[model samples]
Target: MLIVGLTGNIGSGKSSVARLLKEMGARVIDTDQVAREVVAPGTPGLQQIIDHFGTGVLNADGALDRPKMAQIVFNDTNALKRLNSIVHPAIRAQLLKAIADYRDNPDAPLMVIEAPLLIETQLFKLVDQVWMVTVDAKTQIQRVIKRDAVTAEQVSSRLAAQMPQEDKLPYAQRVIDNSGTPEATLQQVRQIWSDAIDRSQAQAE
Candidate 1:
């Protein structure tokens, strides 16, 4: 299978692009969703996190107090790393299983690993091609503010934690300009995926 790594800044429309790709027959794996799943109430991931972060970060019913954890990580760099250390590996394992299961089927032609931290976390190595979705910094800030319902300062701080758009360009084999309308983005991605899948098929043979 052609494993395409899809990534973008906080609100650059990676999920929307992934949704469009899924509609076009690509199997899409979302790491953020998988991370949440592994840590849901009755899981080992949840237990481990609780063990580390303590009950202060858990609800009365035992689900994670995401806001508490988010508040902790945003201001404390080490706390963010600790959280990632606890969650990223499990998510990676799950994502690998998903990729393997999909590839085992002869019919599986292409698949996508939709992850925000693909480049930052060095996940681009696993995929056949790395695609970065980009928008102007102003657009990114606007979208993220609306999406996260946070202040401009909050958005800027979060965006600053990762590598910039220009830095990602060197690593991205394909770039999707999501600065345009959703329809235009979808059109571009479909064309790119078609060409990318064709190349991957040729290489595998």
Candidate 2:
């Protein structure tokens, strides 16, 4: 399988690219969704988090209070590291299992693991290639503020917590510019999808 690690900075439209890939028949594994599942109520992942960060991170509905947890860790590097220590291993195991399941599926020529922290968390090591989605900083900030309904300061803080987009560029084998309209972005995705299929078929031969 041609396993691609799909990643981008906040508001760079990584999910949009993943969606387009899914529409084109690639099996896409979204790590963010997997992360939430691992920490859902009654899971060992949730229990580990509660044990470390306390019950304040839980909602009244017994689900994870994600925003609350974000507030607690976003500014604190040690706290963030601690949380990752608890969560990333569980996520990695699940990702490996998903990849294995899809590896033999002839229908899925491409497997995209969509992770915002693909490089930071070293998940890129598991993929055959890295496809990064990028947008200008101004557009990125505007998109994030609008999508998240957060103040500029809050968005800046979240951005600061992540590795800068420039630093990640060197690690990417392909970069998808997402600063244009949805149609433009879709065109880029289609081109990449076509090339990826050719590469996969060549390797199989």
Q: Pick the candidate with the highest lDDT.
A: 2
Where does candidate 2 have its weakest 10-residue lDDT segment?
100-109
* RMSD to truth, every model: 1.7, 1.5
Angstrom error of the Cα, residue 105, model 2: value is 2.9
Model 1 ranges with Cα > 4 A deviation: none
The digit string of per-residue lDDT tens for model 1 on 60-135 reads 8889988888988978889888888988888888887877787787355678899988987778877878988989
- List TM-scores for all candidates, in order: 0.92, 0.93
lDDT of 1: 0.86
Model 2 lDDT per residue over 121-198, tens place = 999999999999999989999999999899999889889878999999999999999998999999999999999899
Q: Output the number of the TM-score-best candidate.
A: 2
